[model samples]
Target: MTIQVFLPSQFTAPEIFPVIRDSFGTFSEIPTEVDFEFSNLRFVRPSGIVFLSNVARYLHRSGCRVTFSGMRRETNCIRFLDDSKFFEQHIGQAICEGSSPRSTTQPLREVRHEQSHNWLRSTLIPWLSISSQVPEHDLYNVQTCISEIFNNINDHSSQDVGSIFAQWYPNERRVIISVADFGQGIPNAVRTVEGELSDPLAITRAFDNEFSSKSTPRNRGVGLFDLKQNVVGRFGGRVTVHSLGGAVEFRNVDGSVNTSTYNVNGYCPGTLIDIELSTDRIEITNGERESFTWI
Candidate 1:
């Protein structure tokens, strides 16, 4: 399920270009070859090969694996590729060949969430008509679960600095959603009140029934607590937390516990909330989920 590009010698000049970097965790791994039985390659002359190499490098950094396939073609193309590299570190790299084109001229769309939980409210409103079971009630429960987590993020994590990405798979009867942030993490959030504290201790307090670090509000901060209920008590799913150098997992009806910090990194500096909803009852904030009802 990948593509590779080959390069000839003309495209291998080290002094010809500058290095490029990418954020958004897109460029992390470079694949020597693809894993699919059948694959596609773009044959290019020296110039094309250079273009392909830059493109492959760009994609490779963007969590994509790309290979170069042809390099021994004509010198004119190579000359063009080489000439272009002289002026820019990442000339053609800014735009990947055969990659999704950017519409700089197009306007961006905006979504608003006025006091509404960002994820659930936007997802459930449209999935109502496609559910074969639970329907409204199931949607409500899912919304509640999504709301609790989103609210926790809003209240505890940094705003506009985090993002939530969701995908619903009707054919597979699964919905996966992840909310992540790049801000002060759980341990740091707690230290604002309890001074310096150990990662394990901070994580343990997060679920200690009567523990909370919210100085402004007096509620036990039931958002995480309630989210755990929906995952374990209601649906046959699991809940996991990876932060402050520790990892915790809450099992289903089996009431088992799995804890490990063997290789846990420093405070997440961000949070990732992942949920899998398997019931046919499908509930979402936006109508987008209904698109797959035919499956």
Candidate 2:
């Protein structure tokens, strides 16, 4: 039998997790076909777009005959998805026929480890410089934080592939970047060492400066901590991570670090990290720079 799924109008994390769980939960019996209805989708954040892409990629890889319908081409949301290469990469020509050809100039793209350094150095940094005029020094720190995130994926995620979606909103002077992986979720990985811990606590432990799943001497588990410092502390951006059935968010609002965590009804399969950076709030420092090291 075919399964029909309808997407919600606002597709952001935590709030959209139930929708995603319900949609993917229908595949328990291995339906012959899955039809995704996108008619009502009008707003999507970077995390939402990444979540959609992740679902589509998972369905495609599972040998399901998937079809997308009700996506109005005139809607800016559709245009954003199209420009992000979502349709091209996931639905391909089968459903995008007669639609505007996918634009090659979009900011969102999948990032692989081999190409990550160059993508950050050549593409991301230059774009941030031109679009936001972020100071070169601050950009370096941002690059370091991003590189550590990529390293965390490579070293800990066990999945070699991940998707990154980024967009710069000039009006808000903010940039949102989302990185996702479909490997073992963070809680499961951390459980390998921490014994039996709740998913929410495991996620919280992940931000600790000395927590590492690996037992090696060189593994300091400083990536997520340093990432929080750069993104939330320095840039005054927000970092949200959803893994397994727990979600954690770190934000700097009104000169205070606000952290909130709660449980979700379903698992995210792997991990999703969303970072929102506002250009006007970036803090430039004159402190000494440490040599970049991979974790």
Candidate 3:
């Protein structure tokens, strides 16, 4: 069978999940030729980039012949996708002659699980240090957020690799990154402990400070509590976690940060985390930062 999936025009967390859940989520049942149409793509963020790329990968791995269509039609989004190296990373070669590692953007990248730490230490942090002028030591909170994410992928993703993309907005003094892994999912993992909660509830529970972690000794993670602290409390940015058929968004509204959850169009097969950090608010702490104590 042949399947044609129309990607959303506004490609963000809200827009992409339904397309993912309806088509990519059920690809294996038919597993024939699949074409992902990009003509309708109007706006895109880090979430769209990582999700589309990873979904293509998942399809390919499952023995389906996958093709991307509609690139010939030109739009600003087309230019952004090319410059971000999205097409190149997806197809294993440059789709357009490109200039990258720009002051405002870091092109799409794939990080395998075992090399997560080194990628952080050697590549990502250094580039972040240079681009944002935030210094390496001051980026530990950022590191903690991503490290905990990687540790989550290691323990729950059921896959050895994940993908990441980042964009910097100096005028806004913030950087946004999205990471994805094709594994079970936050809802699936948290359900093992919480037992049969809804996707949104399970995901919310995982981030709650009172929740207990079940990771192995080799992969210790305090779950999303610390991630929330680093991103919202420390860096003054928003963090959104999307998994299964639900998503939870945490951001500052007025002077207080609040949590909210809702369901999306379909289940996200793996976990995709969107992290926003305020570059102007980078802080270098003295001694050790306090860890959240489980209640």
Which number leads on lDDT?
A: 3
Query: Per-residue lDDT for 128-225 in model 3, tens only?
Result: 88888877877866886797788778878766789898888877777898999988888888888778999888888888764544744332335577
For candidate 2, lDDT tens digit of each residue in 43-131?
A: 87878777767766767777888888898988878876776677777755423335443222234567877788788888877777777
Between prediction 2 and prediction 3, which has the larger TM-score? Answer: 3
* Runs with alpha carbons beyond 4 Å of true place in candidate 2: 26-30, 93-106, 217-221, 253-256, 283-295
Residue 73: error of model 2 in Å?
1.0
- Order of models, best lDDT first: 3, 2, 1
Question: Relative to the unseen true structure, what is the Cα RMSD of model 3?
Answer: 2.8
For all candidates, the clash counts are 24, 0, 3
Query: What value does the lDDT take at residue 87 in candidate 1?
Result: 16
Q: How many clashing residue pairs, candidate 3?
A: 3
**Model 1 lDDT tens row, 209-235:** 535677654345355665666665566
Q: How much is 47 displaced in model 1, in angstroms?
A: 38
Against the hidden reference, what TM-scores do the models get? 0.50, 0.87, 0.90
Off by over 4 Å in 1: 1-119, 122-125, 128-134, 194-197, 218-221, 253-267, 280-295
Q: How close is candidate 3 to the true structure, as a TM-score?
A: 0.90
Higher-TM-score candidate of 1 and 3:
3
Model 3, runs deviating above 4 Å: 24-30, 99-101, 210-221, 253-256, 284-295
lDDT for model 3, on a 0 to 1 scale?
0.78
Top of the candidates by TM-score? 3
The lDDT of each candidate is 0.41, 0.75, 0.78
